[model samples]
Target: MKINKLLILAALPMIGLTANAQDKGPQKNDFTVAATVSYNNTVMQNAAVGTLPSYNGFQAQSTNWNDKSLQVGIEGGWFFLDEWKLVLGGGMSITKHPGYSGVPGSADSDESFEWGDVPSYGAVADQNFVQFNVYTGVDRYFKTKVDGLYLYAGARVGYAYGRNISFTDDEYNMGKSVGEAFNVRGALTGGVEYYITDGLFVGAQVDPFAYTYNRSLIKPQEGLSNLDANSHNYSILAAPTIKIGFKF
Candidate 1:
């Protein structure tokens, strides 16, 4: 069911591609609105478990860990001048481990295991992670001389919040805390868009460079106060983005 939903979302940009081509793309005073979708799969390596509980079960003999997510976003832009646009947008992402069982050698097994298979597999509930962000930016399009094609570049600043909540047990006896993070980020983005018609187009973009400041908080146990962690990071962030939209 989930895979089907993701497949549908991924195919959105292809819907209007067969429309009649427009003689020109966006011009001054034109407005653009778009929806973006993205997916990410990240492989995680071993990490130090400093000062944390050394519980066994799922954590024992860990072999692999992966983080996966699907995101949806919307944006609106105003062509304030020829070849220049002012944009504002926001997005939300949901992360889940549909097939991963935090145990060694079980991640790729075709056999499905139930919670009863492992007595200490309380961590199975650690499947949901969610994030949201909003941003404002400017974009520039360089004429390519080729009809229906344009090169794009942009810069944006955004604020984001994310949380991962899990349980020590399925019941409320050992309530879990939310692992939460707040981030302020900036990025330089570039892409290409081709107008299928005067008002419709599809494009792909990437954040080749980005900077972020993050503050994370988590509680060790049900009744405990949160512990704080802060960090500054710079990297090429995010997966390739797919966008579909209309300009008028």
Candidate 2:
């Protein structure tokens, strides 16, 4: 009798839980939290490459900062219609762009590269970048399921903030300096998710966007007054990103 009562008491709580779960209907959410990793490639170039007074490639400074990066951000929104989700999200990507110390021309500047593996223009100075991005997008979830899988596609537009590369030559005490630039870009993404539990899901997302910047200051000649400082065009701004995050 004692064992029977204990089992009955234990089962009573589970029964109540099941009943409660059934009574709550479907889950309705107006907000969501997202954390993601983004792989970006930044490229900028002179709009008038060979036609202008500036260096052919000197439209703006370029960095691999948006290269392969990681991002963490949050999103919240309302579900206006059951078949469509209006989602908004923002995030910051922190990355370690490989610094070039040897190769000049395409790799870096000819400012301060003195003692390195490749050659010497000045003292070997490193070049890199870091950035933060804010994004907003809307996705349409398909109303079909094979084994509880939902497909979605959306577009994102936002701003990116980062610091340009700067270095000085110890030989002539000349330092390279560039101003910070905030640029705008857009992304198109699509993904599929399978719910393993009530609030736990796993999925994949991809974004292809462009990253750009302005041309910074570079000392072309060594202490020559009659000579002019030549500005080079930046590289291209285009990258495809793959992402994985969560919803809470």
Model 2, global lDDT: 0.47
Q: Assess the local accuracy of residue 211 in candidate 1 as a C-alpha lDDT between 0 and 100.
A: 75
- Which residue pairs of candidate 1 clash? none
Tens digits of lDDT, candidate 1, 1-248: 99999988887666445333435688999999998886432212122122354333222111111133665667899999989999998767787744223334333333665554543332344446787777899999987877789898989887767777655443422345456667677889898998877899899988788776767666556666666666666767455789999999
Provide TM-scores for the models.
Answer: 0.57, 0.48
* 1-248 per-residue lDDT for model 2 (tens digits): 99999999999999987665433211345344444445443322211111113334333344444444554445554455554667665545444333234323332445644455355343453444555656666777764435346777777666556654545444443344433445555556676655444344556655443333333333333353221122222323233333333444
- Report how far off residue 126 is in candidate 2 (Å): 14
